[model samples]
Target: MVNKPQKTKLSSVISLSHSESTRIFEKKSDLEVWSAFDKGDEMAFNYIYRGFTPIMFSFGIQITNNVDLVKDCIQNIFIDLRRKRGALSEVISIKSYLLKILQRELFRSIKKESIHSIQNIELPESAFLIEVSHETKVIQLESETEINTQLKMALNQLTARQRQAIVLLYEEGMSYREIAEVLEFNEVKSARKLVYRAIESLKQILKN
Candidate 1:
């Protein structure tokens, strides 16, 4: 039951425009759906949860190892949202909006438990822990068990903020502006720097 990142970008300089175009359309549609859901559309609300719960779950786990707590926080947020329906503001990106809300809620829960976050970043938790899929093609050369262990160890070494940056930028495919909104960074430049530094740090650590 290893759930990891999915639908990674296929390298193709030729189709870059088409890919970006498709992405933009999808983002626009998601925003529209969210707007409808905000206005008391039950079907639209369910649609959002069905599509994003898994991704949100993955993101939540990076913040804390308590799977049950993460699940509760997710459901709780939606329950609160449902209660506050029709008052919700227009959102540019549903994923970013949801992540921002979820992050705030998760941080509150983590604080009650008195957990220490990595690098003392704002609202930080311990090293962002992750579970890699054994099926990842890049690690196919190594035995599954060995590769999985290595991947987890490497991820565990990263600060919480770095891991959050990696998950948002890569796994969720968020733009820097969207990431800044979700992570509450002061500027988009800070989000970009965080992602770049995280990648460089991962490359160095994983090469060992």
Candidate 2:
């Protein structure tokens, strides 16, 4: 039998030319892009996904130490964008709008975790093995321990719902609208009030 060379697939090697790449960004204003996206413009949505995913990823990492959780939060936010597309409207800025969505999603995830966190067992001692000088170590340990103690005191100062709202909005970066949706509050104002009251309580707690 004669030997024959195997053909490799070339389809995957296709790439965007420089002009094509430039055209994508130069094509539309933010409002126009999102308005089209609202009506099911897949291209617009794809552009939005590409532009905002990294920002969301950064915010997620800052709030949650778990990379997997960050990935899951971002994926869920994009899924939400698709799911809510029909109701989207012209906004002041696409970047801000996308960030708000990401913020809301991350907060929702954090609130859920906080609710379930009590069930978590203590981590092994090996998790705290980083080294420093004895004085620095003592200061670091005392700082973290004091923060936890103060946080608990602050939590006790607020009503349960207020505490949850504060944690989700301030700690987790969720917006008032998202907090309303998650908590079944009547409006964003209500969510804002919940957080506001909680902050006041926390200030009082810290002062004492």
Candidate 3:
């Protein structure tokens, strides 16, 4: 198993990313960064990697069972981006674009292996990782254990795609268009519909 980074350090990294992610991701700023990145800007490249690497790891292990493979894929994605930056297409959301890369890379890795065994072995752990924050629940145990359980239970009731859509829509604050692009859907409206259906399913799961 590839070592998952400690939550404390990941939290600090994400905290730092909040401002940098915001600044570089503003509407005009995104174009500026991409323009600079395309022209072989090392600072721009480092900024993108530092800002995204942590969450990308968390997201990747869900898509593929092999943590090591996920780690390698992450590096490969960035390396390819750096090498081909000049020919890259303009994108609306860099986060979404990066997510698309992660998903595609994971899919490629999965296809080359014996997927059935890996999927069966890893699905439960990966699903839980995505659904419940271990650190969040620890402090909340005294006050809100039931709420936490309810969320995990509700998330468990979802299909994997539904769970992914819900997380992207609510937690990541991605718009439908961005989600459509990341998920490779033909239309943005489909992404919105999927999220709505996931929300309704969660409500039904919690009710019952």
Candidate 4:
């Protein structure tokens, strides 16, 4: 289990590990991409789509626990983003904006699914991890699989928001400012606070 200080230190590591010098994409900023897209640059739109889709996919799968549903929701999200581009407000960080949209789309799908089902449908924690690990274990051993399963169970014990925080802060390697923007926090400090709280909860949950 990662302690508060250790997790806080890990957060810094997570934030800094990604090299700012590396060119992950040619485009500089979302606003720049948006401008090019507005000018009818299909390639610019494609670039944005490619950059954001994986994050959206992971987030969607986590919240909804339905692969097809996640695909549908993400498609719809891009459609909506395109449709609302003319009225798109100033966003501090494009990553955060995309995350917020993905979360909204995921929740909407969940609500719809709930209404359609007469009985409550409970999705296990780290459902996306299950999908990814399935193929990995096929090439590996049973003991490793068991350990991975237990780790996923540990992750499942976290609250929904905490899970989200941990994923964004650790797995996705987003900065506190970016997470703050995604979560609609007034400041980055609040975002850090959320992550710290989530980490503490996860440590306690995993320790037991």
What TM-score does each of the candidates earn?
0.69, 0.45, 0.75, 0.65
Alpha-carbon deviation at 158 in model 2, angstroms? 24
> What's the count of clashing pairs in each model shown?
2, 0, 0, 0
lDDT head-to-head 1 vs 2, winner: 1
Best by TM-score: 3
lDDT of 2 by residue, 131-180 (tens): 22323421234456567566555565566466446545654466787667
CA RMSD of all predictions? 11.1, 11.5, 7.4, 13.2
Q: Comparing candidate 3 with candidate 4, which one achieves the higher lDDT?
A: 3
Which segments of candidate 1 are over 4 A away from where they belong? 1-28, 113-127, 131-155, 203-208
- The top-ranked prediction according to lDDT is 1
Full-model lDDT for every candidate: 0.71, 0.57, 0.70, 0.63
Task: For residue 80, give model 4's deviation from the true position in Å.
Answer: 2.3
Alpha-carbon deviation at 167 in model 1, angstroms: 2.0
> How many clashing residue pairs are found in candidate 1?
2
Candidate 4 residue pairs in clash (backbone atoms < 3 Å): none
| Decreasing TM-score order of the candidates | 3, 1, 4, 2
Of the candidates numbered 2 and 3, which has the greater lDDT value? 3
Q: Tens-digit lDDT track for model 4 on 10-63?
A: 234324312332243364676776666556454555666766778788777776
- In the range 128-190, model 3's lDDT, one tens digit per residue, is 234465454222343366777777777868877887777677667788998898888999999
